[model samples]
Every structure is written in structure tokens, then in C-alpha cells.
Target: MTDQPAIELNNGVRIPQLGFGTFQVDSDETQRIVETALEAGYRHIDTAAGYYNEDGVGAALKASGLARDDVFLTTKLRNGDQGHDSALAAFEASRKALDVDVVDLYLIHWPTPTRWLAPETWRAFEKLLADGAVRAIGVSNFLPHHLGRLLETAGVTPAVNQFEIHPTHQQPAVQDASRAAGIAVEAYAPIGKGEDLSEEAVEAIAQAHDVSPAQVVIRWHLQQGRIVIPKSATPERIRSNIDVFGFELTTGQLDALTGLERANRLFPNPDEFEASQFRD
Candidate 1:
């Protein structure tokens, strides 16, 4: 049995605190890799339309033989597909691609604020939740200001706010804002995509715990009460990623990891980023 705990969202949906992510996992390899993650005891899987691997994720889910409700699946609307009508259409396409009648959580992939489309797109997500097409709705890469703007007229408070969070990018303001708004925080790139795993503090914690640095980081996220999704296609790492429930970090170690934060962000600022930059 999986030892991962679940955190309740504002909408009362409980999501696994630790999950498997399929960000850069190629579409061709997603099926086998995702299946491996499931076999390794990951009950939650994070995917997105822009990842271009929903079909493969769907195939793995079908092949896993687990009941549909046994897994918590999350997918996002592509940044290129914003606005009310396009967002609705994109959700339909993603639903078909994932072969699911209703996804557990659906998210706006990015605010793309330059397009001024997040509020419009969020309206579409609200409709999906109301229609029972999705169990929960949230946004990714959104900061407090973005959320503040959306909340002014939003019919529903977002259940979660997912963003790039790691030891090097703690985002205290965002975390505080989300907590004030009663939105759960979900951390993507929880280990900074293997960037800071070798750092002195992380390694020191790893050594003390007799675990890998990645595990220490994952545990750190958990200790902070944020949901974390760490991705890996390799079988060994995939299994080891889910083994974090066995250890707990000391308060001093947790503080050390917190001290590693330099507010370093690896992605474009949502307020300034445009979806067109990703196009050929």
C-alpha cells in the first residue's frame, strides 16, 4: 500500500501530497514510464496538454488495470489555447486525449497575462467543474497579483495554485498568499529538475537521513504542507521518488533547505510571458 498522505483542497477533493509528473517525458515513452510510476505506487499523476503526452498517459492508465477512481489525474489547458471558447474546446480535446470522461483536476497551464486571457479561460474551467466534467479546478504559474485579479470577479475560488517551487525558489509570498486565500499549493520541479540535489545543504541532509538528496528535498516539500510532483522516467529513480514516506527531516535540516532559497525562478514570469514564444 502507498504511504503517501492526502491534502484536502478548498473544494474538498483530497489529492496525494506526492505525485508523479510527466512534464518532459516524451510522448513515445510516456506509456511505459507512466506505467512504471503506477507500479512503483504513485496514485497521483500530473500531465498537461502542452506536454503532448496525454494519449500515452491515457494508455498507461488503461493498461494499469486499476479502477478509474484509484488514481488522481490532473491535466492543464495549453497556454496557446486561452479565452473562453478556446479554453472550453481545449478541455474537450484534452478529455478525449486522456480517454477520461472527467478529470480529477483541470488547470489553466499558464496565466499568459500579456494575452489578458486567464480570467476568460478560468470562466471555462468553472463551467467544467459545474458540469461535473472535472472534480476540481486550479491554475499553474499564477502569482498573488494574478490571483488577486481573478478573485475580483471569480464565481469560485481556485482550489489550488501550482507553480515552480523548489529549495532554490521558495516563493514565500506566493505561498503566503495562497494560504490566505485558502488555496492549496502544489510544487512543480520540487527538486529543481535535479539542479540543486548536489548542493551542500541538500547533500548534508541526505547523508544524515541515509537517503538520496532528492528524497530529502521531496520530504522537505512534504514537511512544508505543499503537494510536490517529481518526475523521472528511469525505473530506479521513479521507484525511489515515491519512497519518501519512510523518512522525516529534522527542523534544523528543514530550516537549512529554506535558507537555500534565493528566489531563483527557472521559468518565464507569467505577467510578461506570451504563449506565441513557444510556437515555431
Candidate 2:
């Protein structure tokens, strides 16, 4: 009965467009919070090794007693593990931590171009795909130039390019590049994490639809064809975020949200970010 739609990747893998994310979610609370998300009807769950909560995510899944295939799971490699050998080892560890024989989707986490090492790391990703260790491979936080460099010798075009995208900071240039290359764009920090929830257009649209501003913003992303993952630790908000299927936005309302774009990119610029995932 869930109204979530699935988008087909270039490699023929279908992913749920609406998902629950555990970015800043704490490890101790991840299991319960994720279990709530599952019970609330979220079939897609996004976690990462860098998030330090993959074990909790796995526990939540186990506790729900849902078939492994019943949910689409996605995780990313830490920036610290960006070489062929290291990436391979990291994937194995992540798979073990999540207790999945084959991961639904695996991403490079960030271009963090040592991304001189990106091609090398990508080779490992290709190997994983070839060995059937993962269903699909993609990148996160990549820009046009980053994508360009990665594609120069890329054997498989990335199936997705996840990054920070919201009403206030839409990376149209990046989105255009990814779409043109047939790579799906997935939005992270999709609601600006409350940064722009009070924008005039968003507020107006929400008021008109009798929905929360977060829902208005999420609906905007869905209508425009971007895969969005919104996170909330609170049970009510988690359910509320996914309740977007109940309403539709008019073209004007959609455009109003579009007009709110300031091209204000958040997060580290992939071109210059050199930090790696911190190890405990």
C-alpha cells in the first residue's frame, strides 16, 4: 500500500525513490529508529560505514523480520578506504557488518579525488559487481569535473550520484551532467536539514496543501524526479516525511520551490575536500 515509486538505474537495478537515511543518527539509537522506519512502511534504508551505525541498521532489519529483499539497502565506502585493495576489503567488512551476502547498492561515498585513486577504487567496484558482491555501484558528492574524470576510463557509468540537494541549494549543473550521462541523481540533506524550512515559497506551498514544510519540500523533489532520502529520529516525523504520497503540488507550487534555489551548495566541495572518514 506504500505509494513509493522506483527508478531504474542505468544498469537495470530499480531503487525506491523515497528512503530513510541515517546520516547523523547515533549508533545507539539507530536500531530502534530504523525499526520504526521499517514498521512505518519504508522499504529503502540508507546507511554508511562512515556513519558508524551499519550494525544497528542490520539489527533493525533483523528485528523487523522482513525478508532481505523486502528492503533496498545502500551503504557507502569511507573516504579513508578509496583504493582498489582497500575498497575491496572495506566492502567485505561492510557486507559482514550488515550481514548481507549481496549489497543492493554500493557507493564510493565521496569523490575526495585521491580521486586520483578514484579510478583505482572504481576498478574494485567493478570487480565487486563482476563477482556479484554488489548489485550496483555509484558515487556520491561528485561534480561535473569529478564525473568527467571518473568516466574517462570508467567501464560502467555510475548508476547514481548522491549529493546535497534541497530547495535552497539545487546543484542544477551537477544534476544536468548526471542525467545527461544517464546517472540517477539522489538527494541527501534533502530538506536542507531544517535550514530553509521557513522559506516563503515552501511555507506558502505547505499552507496551501495543509502539509508540513518538510513534506512540501520532499514532494517537490519527487515531482521533479530526484531520488530523496529524508531522515528523522522521531517516529512521528519519520512517518510524516513519507506521507508525501497523499498530496500533489501544482506546477506553480513546484516552480515556486524551484525559484527558491540559490545555487548555494552545502558540504565540502569535492574538488578540494581531502578529509577521510575518521576511524575509531
TM-score for each of the candidates: 0.97, 0.98
In the range 29-117, model 2's lDDT, one tens digit per residue, is: 99999999999999999999999999999999999989998899999999999999999999999999998898989999888865478
- Candidate 2 has its poorest 10 consecutive residues by lDDT at 108-117
Model 1 residue runs over 4 Å out of place are 276-279
**Model 1 Cα lDDT, one tens digit per residue, 195-268:** 98989999988998899999999999999999999999899999998898888988999999999998788877
True lDDT of residue 204, candidate 1: 85
Q: Return the clash pairs for model 2, or none.
A: 114-117
| Residue 219 displacement (Å), model 1 | 0.3
Q: lDDT, candidate 2, residue 64?
A: 94
Which regions of candidate 2 fall more than 4 Å away from where they truly are?
Answer: 1-3
In angstroms, how far off is 44's CA in candidate 1? 0.6
Candidate 2 local Cα displacement, residue 164, angstroms: 0.6
